[model samples]
Target: MIRHLVLFKLNDGVVRDDPRVVEGARIFASLGEKIPELRFWECGWNVSDRPIAYDFAINSAVEDAEALRAYVEHPEHQAGVALWREFATWVIADYEF
Candidate 1:
């Protein structure tokens, strides 16, 4: 399986409660049901307030690299990316275990 992880940090002045942020989270939360290639999905706000922590995170798994690619290229996923791009910056990692 391919493990895909992402960390998101809201842009300066963008708070978690902002409508756009909430909607972005909602969009991501819906992906597990919408994307068939996803074998696992978990996303949420970070509980820590530490300066080093990201504001949100995503942990997901796919059957393989091909499924991971399909998930990334999926239109719904693209829509979520477009929305989040407006208010946050993110980092990601993909690995196999």
Candidate 2:
């Protein structure tokens, strides 16, 4: 299996309560149900206020690299990404287990 993790930092002046950000989070929150390749999914806003902490995070898993690719290319996933691009920047890591 492969674990896909992502951390997102909101852009300056962007808050989680903003309509676009809320919609973006909603889109992502639903991707696990919409994408067949997603074997596991957990995502949420951070609870901490640490200076180095990212504002949001996603923890997901797939069967393999191919499944991961399919998840990345899925239309619903792409739509969420497009919306996030306007308000945040993110970093990701994928690893096999």
Candidate with the greatest lDDT versus the true structure: 1
Estimate, for each residue in 45-81, the C-alpha lDDT of model 1 and write its tens digit.
Answer: 9999898999999999999999999999999999999
lDDT of 1: 0.98
- C-alpha RMSD by candidate, in order: 0.5, 0.4
**lDDT (CA) per prediction:** 0.98, 0.96
How does candidate 1 fare on TM-score? Answer: 0.98
Using Cα atoms with residue i matched to residue i, what is each candidate's TM-score against the true structure?
0.98, 0.99
lDDT of 2 by residue, 46-79 (tens): 9998999999999999999999999999999999
TM-score of 2: 0.99
After best superposition, candidate 1 residue 12: deviation in angstroms?
A: 0.3
